[model samples]
Target: MQSIHFISGLPRSGSTLLAALLRQNPRFHAAMSSALAPLVSANLDIMSSGQEVSLLMEESQRPAMLRALFDTFCRTTTEREVFIDTNRSWCAKMPLIADLFPDARVIACVRDVPWVLDSLERLFRKNPYENTRLFGNDGERATVYSRMESLARHNRLVGYPWTALKEAFYGEQADRLLVVDYEILTKAPEKTLRLVYDFIGEPWYEGHDFDNVEYDAPRFDEALGIQGLHRVRPKVAFEPRRTILPPDLFKKYEHMDFWRDTAGSRANVLATKRATREDTTTA
Candidate 1:
């Protein structure tokens, strides 16, 4: 069975960043978001079901739609073994997607809650354009943001809904799931990429040779008329954040010891160190 790899996470949690890095694999045609309309239309089951999807996508029949999608994805792209799609909202629907492609691989990106919340707030407050396609309207953004945080609340005791979902869907299953930290991937691109390549069963590129390869994400958004929302590609360098959350908010959000347990003390240490490093760098 072939694997359809997915990169899922909270919006602004660095899904695109990870996707761009993974796309460096010469054998993969990484799509920011896969188009399911044609595949869904070909399968009647998807058309009939009136399931409401996330703000970013319309829901379709799970089994049929996913099969058709994988089939079409395999057919259209020259790459035979694996193809990648990075969609943050897909994290919420991992169970269904896992059912769709039983053999698929997934990378669930994660960041600190305060950072995620702050990004959500900024995205809503400063959407440069009032474009429905990009920001999905202020009301919708607020609702979706609320829903995500609410979902996050469910595992409040452990603070590991996202990580737990990733694990349940992909982890400890032998050959399918790999969780990549946003901070590590961004800070130490080479080491992380090597690990990812190995996990996907692909050879490391020449000296991790992703240097000049272009991953213009806007190529996909442009066709959908939602170009204003994302960064256009050809990005070659990592720009670590130089800003830090206020001390009070940081303390409040950072108290989730569960994050350390699930992500490991290493990742937690890196996340905090990176945040502090950025503050110093900026100062």
Candidate 2:
């Protein structure tokens, strides 16, 4: 692969769906949560001062090895010209990515915070008999309020990526990021996708098809006890529904979409904050 980009942002914010669409381009390789991050992270650990072997490793080789992970992962796996690795951890590792892939950009897939929580809760309830591994135990999943509290903690799924996205959006390297919202991705796919191509300096693919899409990770989801968690629908369209969250909890996070308040954002946003949903058909 010639260039490696990233797909990151809040959980349940359509990163997998973005990857599904990107993979439609013959020259692009995109997937849900590639192994590159974990590989690079492990290498970073043993190469750091935390490991005595660090004394024998040269500082120059660190970037080389880390960058190799992306290249090797792509080259060995696919012949595609570009690779868009998906991982929420990438948002927290912006400095490392910039140093390694100087010209690369990170595409942050985001959604309204309340909807993010709703998506997770929906998945949990979908599999009524199985408890999702998203929480530590039963008590954590005891109620929608508890689930929301756990998910919104600083280190958990939704909160960590949200925080990391904020850091990247406001940090010195903010210009390396592009914020694309779930609403736009699902409701206005072609337009949103073309914007992504422009953002990454890729020529737009004209033959893109929004419907007849396919993406699923049954094994991955089953392992997490959250079947269909990473699945994308065959048709790309938004299905608006009433908030399952209790009124107060939903109200608390409905306005916490930090990406919307772009006053000081050096990053470019490709979406409006939550729009007034309508019943019109996107197809």
Best by TM-score: 2
Model 2 C-alpha lDDT per residue in residues 75-181, reported as the tens digit of each score: 99888899888999898899998998888999998888877887788888889999888999988989998999999998998889989998999988899999998
Clashes of each: 0, 0
**Model 2 poorest ten-residue lDDT run:** 274-283
Model 2 ranges with Cα > 4 A deviation: 275-283
What does candidate 1's lDDT look like per residue over 1-283, in tens digits? 3456777654455566666666656666565555643344444333444533423344544465568666766667655456777654444454556567665666666665555645544443454453434333455345544423443554431134455544444334423445555566655668877777776667777634445434445555555444433452343345555334455554555533233344422121123232442411100
Every candidate's lDDT: 0.51, 0.85
Task: Specify the poorest-scoring 10-residue window by lDDT in model 1.
Answer: 274-283
For model 2, name the residue pairs that clash. Answer: none
